[model samples]
Target: AFVAALIAGEKAAFHEWEAAPYFEGCLPVEVMAERGPETLRHGPLKPFGLTDPHAPERKPYAVVQLRQDNKLGTLFNMVGFQTKLKHGEQLRVFRTIPGLQHAEFARLGGVHRNTFLNSPKLLDASLRLAAMPRLRFSGQITGCEGYVESAAIGLLAGRFAAAERLGEPIALPPATTAHGALLNHITGGHVDAIEAGPRSFQPMNVNFGLFPPLAEGIRRAGAARTLAKKQALSARALGDLEIWIGRHPAAAAE
Candidate 1:
């Protein structure tokens, strides 16, 4: 019903004026609904670990989580509910959710554009601009998505700059680690298409897909294989990260 409402309300809520490419990590609810009925169920509305007290045996198809927004506990936030729907349409559509029929909203959700650079084309491994090495870029501006990724890039940029200033060698983390994988992604992971006029580099969150394939292939098949692969990757990443830390005592101290 929620997905249906979003699709139906899209015509009234969304129009030409608001059309723009959205960050994949933070897609609008209406846009997600347009993809498929199960998209939201698996993405934002996933009911993985919850039970209805009124009817314990019957499992809920989806769930909406409200996060406390203020100290008073009067205001609550709708988790992962960012939307491009017009104000009236948002009210009309969102009310379709169970238990929100009489809910009063302190504020409505809206979408905004995120600005990012094509880091792979512009920046070096140390995050210094290739054309003008004096200037260094970091954070979301350098095309790494999320708060932690931005901070990690900032830390690396700072370390690199400090090393240069002190006449010390700038050490890079191994690619197996999350920081290294993300850094590689930002600096030179993207491959430009042969037919492309401009590089299609985009901001990305650090994910297992960004990491290199395992050194040794997993022989097992099915869910067990997937689990084993993840465990192996995690163990390898941790071991590599520890070695990297040991090699760079100054960075480890920080």
Candidate 2:
């Protein structure tokens, strides 16, 4: 009943909201709900790995996980609960979770409109604004997706700035490494598809597709081929990353 109500709940902006496109990676809960009754169950709410202590024999159909919002652990936030429902509706809906019947929210959920830059066109190799080298950009604002990717960019930016301050050569990470692959993607890897226009360079999560292929003779036979290929890539990436790190001994000190 709770899931059904959430699915049927009145969203704050019914008309204008429908016209705006949603990023595939962060689709709203109600938007997912509209796909089918079981879409949410299979996607965000899937209960494949978790084992309930009190009901070990019976598998859970769905699960909702809350995350820590602060360092003190006194505040918790729902993990994938982004929504546009009214405050009253949000409280009524979220309180339906098993252990959260009496849950008190420190902050009711809300949505924000986010804007990001087209980094490839606007930023240089070291992530400085091309037209204004005095400024540098990193993280999602520069178009790299996810926490890890954003942090990697931040680390690179810091290193580049430090190298400039110390009068050292700023060595870019090798394209084979994860950091390099992502940096390359945001800088120049993804060319806009003429037909798709701006959508061609849609935000992306790091994956093997972004990495350059393995060496010529590293092929494996039959069932082992796929896993073997991945292993080769991982090994190569790590080795290249080590070499890149070694070149920046000044960065190693910090």
Top-TM-score candidate index: 1
Best candidate per lDDT, number? 1
Number of colliding residue pairs in model 1: 0
lDDT of 1: 0.86
Predicted candidate 2 versus true structure: per-residue lDDT over 77-139, tens digit per residue: 787777888888888888887888898888876665556777888889999999999899988
Per-candidate clashes come to 0, 0
Q: Which ten residues in a row have the lowest lDDT in candidate 2?
A: 193-202
